[model samples]
Target: MDPEVDTTQGGLRIDGRRPLELRRIRLRLGVFSQADGSAYIEQGNTKILATVYGPHQPRGKSVSSMTKATKGIVNCQYSTAVFSFGAGERKKRPRGDRKSIERAQQLKHAMEAIINLELFAKSQMDVFVEVLQVDGSEFCVAVNAATLALIDAGIPIKDYAVGCSITVSDKLLGDDDSGKSTGILDANWVEECSPGVTLSIVALPKVVDETETKSSVILAHGAGQRLHLSQLESLRLRALQGCKDIRTIIDQAVKDHLQIFVVTTALDK
Candidate 1:
């Protein structure tokens, strides 16, 4: 861990932002006319684009039957462009890698949770989340992007899904021996590669439906380290806060998007 990376000093960090603060968020909807729904979001150094298609027909018969006639199926395929890497660096190929496949699965699961699967029935909705830039917490960034895309597509969801990552640092705690210190909030790549642990959480901001079954709700939680049991609560709370913050931002963006939609529709009329 770089002792110089400590936030205590006046030293400037990435984007001149302070520790525990998220990057500036920018969101745009209807980015592409070809897709049923499309959105783009920029979180700090990470930029992502998401597209939603379908609620139409299922490509395969096997999974197609899984969707109920009243409920729609969520078919997600997450990929990153070769140039989506930082500094516009070109990637060799866009797909077929093991990591990409796993990412697609993660996104599929997240989308399945929010979208009421029973509405479209025997139909499939394809969600493609693409990472245009990766600085840190790419998974969280992609999930957020996908949420906006779903909204743009006019897909009904129980709630918006927000994801966040946390990492501990050695030097930040002023004790290299205590490499397990918990750093609440965002963790860059350097912090991720260090001796610290990382946790990624995807959650529904608030359970608005009291009659709905909460236990069945999906909460994707990943922990890399065996931290002290006592610290678990704080980590969980902080991650939830991150999720809430993301929800707030997305909620506002959704409102703005709808306003634009109303204006556009009125003009067309």
Candidate 2:
């Protein structure tokens, strides 16, 4: 572990955020006039733009003959600006590389899990995400931006698939009122790239009865050092809380946009 990566600076993180404190999240929907739907988001220094198109005809690689018979299809493409990498890192070509393709596929599955694919039988939904700035929690930001775009396109979904990430520092702080481990939530590029366990989660941000069987988690991915079994639950709770908080922000943005649109239309009439 790097000595400088010590995130528990008196219970504060590298970016001056306390445990469970999320980065500043700002999002806007219907950002583009031509696309069926579009959105842009900024989480700390990580910024992403997502656009959604279609419920239109499914053709080419986006759909196959068999898929057209069974249900709708989703095609996701993720890309990064050439300058989006960290400042000191060598700038690489941003062509459809293997990493981007894998990220795209992962994002597509996350969206598919929430979408009512059966409703758009024989159709296709195309989602394109572009990373304008590079930072940690890249994948989670992509998932979030895409979800808002889908909503803007008026696609029906079972639930909001919110994404959040957490990272463990070399030391733990348990002096807070909760007396729980102060795990790092919403790591920045510097903290995330250093060294430690990092976990990313995408899930439905809903409260369900403990007696019920359904779960909120859709996907959980981890990288860096292996996390201990004991700490997993704590990390899960922090990430889930972050997800729930973000969902609330997105919902408010959508409602605000709608209210503005309604007022504009009323005046035009």
Best by lDDT: 2
**Candidate 1 lDDT:** 0.74
Question: What C-alpha lDDT do the candidate models reach, one value each?
Answer: 0.74, 0.82
TM-score of 1: 0.84
- Show the lowest summed lDDT stretch of 10 residues, model 2: 206-215
Q: What tens-digit string does per-residue lDDT give for candidate 2 at 8-110? A: 3564666667667889998899999899989999999999999999889987865556453767888899999888886666447564888888888889899
For candidate 2, list the clashing residue pairs, or say none. none
| Every candidate's CA RMSD | 4.3, 3.3
Name the regions of candidate 2 deviating beyond 4 angstroms.
1-10, 66-68, 171-182, 207-215
Q: Model 1 — which ten-residue stretch has the worst lDDT?
A: 210-219
Count of clashing residue pairs in every prediction? 11, 0
Error of 2 at 157 (Å): 1.4
Write one digit per residue (lDDT tens) for candidate 1, span 20-107.
6677788898899999899898877788899999778777763747644566667777777887765646877686688788888888
